[model samples]
Target: MVTVNEAKQLIIANTQLLEKQKCALDEALGRVLAEDVIAPISLPPFRQSSMDGYAIIHTDITQKGTPLTISGESKAGQADLPELKPGSTIRIFTGAPVPVGATAVVMQENTARENGTLTINEYPIPDGKNIRRVGQQIREGAVALGAGSLVSPGAIGFLKGMNMNEVIVHRKPKIGLLVTGDELLKAGDALVPGKIYESNSAMLAAALTNAGASEIEVKYAADDFAATAEALAALIRDNDVVLASGGISVGDYDFVGTALESLGAETIFYKVRQKPGKPLLFGKKDGKLIFALPGNPASSLVCYYEYVLPALRRMTGWSDPFLRALQLPVRYGYSFDGERDEFLKAKIEGSEVVQLDGQESFVIGSFAVADALIYLPVHQNKIEAGELVEVHLLPV
Candidate 1:
């Protein structure tokens, strides 16, 4: 068995980045940019009015209460703008282009206009007031967003404002999920003695989707050696990454390890020194990655978060793919002396983290309400109340 850090390092060292693809802005949310996006043109494109006011040369407002003739009106989106004659102003609305000779704008609220004449009630209007110069937000040919940046909703709007229809981003991974167990039955099926409803498939699928995976195919296989091998082979052949839930432990019916060996898969690491998911296995065949998780639902989910999720993010060209970590105080005292590191389901209450009940590998009730995982190293046995502990915040 490998240490948790060693396991994580091996997975990352073995993972390779996927190919880049051009993605339309409409469908690029949550994708990592493969290249920097440059602004094609300056934002605003021209000097623009930031308020509904009058555009005039600063010298025209010689003193307080100075009156100037309102030469013409300039509404937003107007292509033809009236020239501002000497000692005169133009009634301009927000986002309208400033006239050629105008150097300042006084908001309408600070001025009074009637009968084609405008008076400034406030004195000494600052030069270039309420005017957004060309390239105020971004200049042409400047980098809008650097590579490795995650495209967010706001980024989409920003890129659209830059007149970009598509962006170059790393392609999402295609995953093949295989669930193995003879005693497992699908939901809504009548369960016989010693049989239970299988839920790991649906649970892991949702988790994968949350991590930005879109192309996922699921398969079921019985515990028999041949059937398991056949199903595993097919999954490896069809997908870039394969995830097998169950049949990796030392039990008599476990066949995932043997199947992988027979198929010439290289075992990068077999197990990790961690609670809830000690039987996790990682390997590679050809250029495809594979992960075999423990049969218990909670163990499988924990392994996915700690190991598989990071690998997927790395493959998609993310620079920082690990879970968000923080040091938080514990709400209550807890004690445990185990041979391996423990990850307990927890929820943050105000400034402290509270460990939830039912943390067994087979129980997932507490995990349902958990928003973080409190990490407990192998050497530590007890935590007093109000003590600091490392916590990893879940993506949700």
Candidate 2:
């Protein structure tokens, strides 16, 4: 048995980043950049007006209620008609390029119009006011984004603005999932005496997808040695990572761990010092990765977040490796074994993580209402209500 932190370190050290490929901006979402992106042109491209008003020289507005002649009207994307003289102003709309020799803008509400001329109001005019300068947000030829940065909506927009249509990014990894049990049945099947619906497969698949996997293949292996071995072999051959649920504990039907060992896989870790998910197995064979999680629903989710997610991130080439969780104060108190770590299902309420009642390993309803996983470390008996604990936030 090993601790979760030790297992995670081994997994990250073993996995390498996937190959990089040139992809269009639309397909780069959720991908990590493999190359630095430099800005080809300045953002905004030119000095422009920030309001729907008039562009004028600040020196012309020395007296209150002074009137200035209107020279021309300029709207966004329109050509700058002419330069404004000392006593002349140009009618300008929002985002219009500031005309030559103009350094300030006055909103229409602050000025009154009469006889095709505008008069200044009570506000004092300042030079270069309400004008956005070129390259104010991003300068030309500067590194806008560094390598290994995750691409999001803001990143996509920034890349496009910088004329970066294609980018080099790490390829998403492929995953295989296997659910094993003799007493498990798929949905729409008749429930036999000791059978329950198979749910871990679908849940694990969804989680892998959310973690940015390129492809996911799911299968069911009955509680037979040969059948489980066959499924495992196929998965190892087809995917970069394999996630198997159940058949790893010390039971008659627990053949997943034994099968991998028989196949000459170096079992890096067998069990973790954690509750609700002690039967977690991690190993490698032929340069491919595998994870065996307990069949219990809550345990499976906890293991996925703690062990599997970090491995996925490593495979995808994320350089700054760290798990994201909401560190909040506990809302409820409970006691646990002093030698094992525990993850309790909790809901975030008014900045406090309220632990859900009846959080057994098999219960799914509490898992559904849970927004985070509150972790209690080993050697701790109970967490007080106000103690700050690390929380692994879940997708809503």
Candidate 3:
């Protein structure tokens, strides 16, 4: 069995970066940029007004309530701006182009306009106030966003403002998920003998989706050697990464690991020195990556966060893909039972953390309310009330 760090390195070392693809701005959310996005034209391409008021030269407002004749009106989306003649001002709405020789916009509330006259009530309106200067937001040919940046919702609107319709980004991965077991049944199915409702498939699928894999294909195998082998082979050939939940341990029905080896995949690592998910299996073909996690729902999710998540990030060209982890003091003491390091489900409140109940691999009841996972090393038998421990924060 490999250590957790060694296991993670093995998975990352075998991952190959996927090729970049062009996508519309609407589809670019949560994707990493593959190239720099250069602005074709400056944002607010022309000097524009930011307020609905009178545009005037700053020096023209010499005293309080100084009157100036309104020359014309400039509304948003107008083709031409009426220029401000000497001793005159133009009424401009928000987002309207600022006329030539206009220095500021005195908000209508600050000015009293009757007939064609305007005045400044707000004393000493600063130069460039209420006006968005040309190229002020973004300059033409400037790097609007650098390569490797994550495209967020704000980025979409910003890119649109920069006149970009399409962008080159590391494409979201396509995943193939195989749920294996003969004793598993769907939620609505009847439970007979030792059969139980399947939950790992849903858990794994949700995790992969949260990790930004949009194209997911899920299937089930009945622990039969032929069925497991056929499903594993197809998944390996059809997806960027394959996540198989169950059948990885050394049981008579455990066929996932054997199926992977029979498919000519190079096994990177098998088990890890960790609790909850000790039967993890990682293998790779020439370029495709496969991870076979334990059958238990909680165990599968723990492995997904610790191992599968980083692999997805590496494939999609992320600089850092691991979960945000930090150390905090424990609020309760615990007795250790196993030699393997354990990732105990817990909640963090203020500066302290408390381990939750139901930490058994099959019990996911406590996991629902958990915000983080506390890491307890192998040799540490007890946790003092105020001892610091590392925590892996879950995605909110």
Give the per-residue Cα lDDT of candidate 3 at 169: 79
- Highest TM-score model number: 1
Q: What is candidate 2's lDDT per residue for 1-32, written digit by digit as tens? A: 88867877887888888888888999888888
Off by over 4 Å in 2: 122-124, 320-322
C-alpha lDDT score of every prediction, in listed order = 0.93, 0.86, 0.88
Off by over 4 Å in 3: 327-331, 335-338, 348-354, 378-388
Residues 219-309 of candidate 1 have per-residue lDDT tens digits of 9999989999999999999999999999999999999999999999999999899998999999999899999999999899899999999
lDDT of 2: 0.86
Candidate that scores best on lDDT: 1
> By TM-score, is 2 or 3 better?
2
lDDT of 3: 0.88
By lDDT rank, best first, the candidates go 1, 3, 2
Q: How does model 3 score by TM-score? A: 0.91
TM-score of each: 0.97, 0.94, 0.91
Model 3 pairs whose backbones collide: none
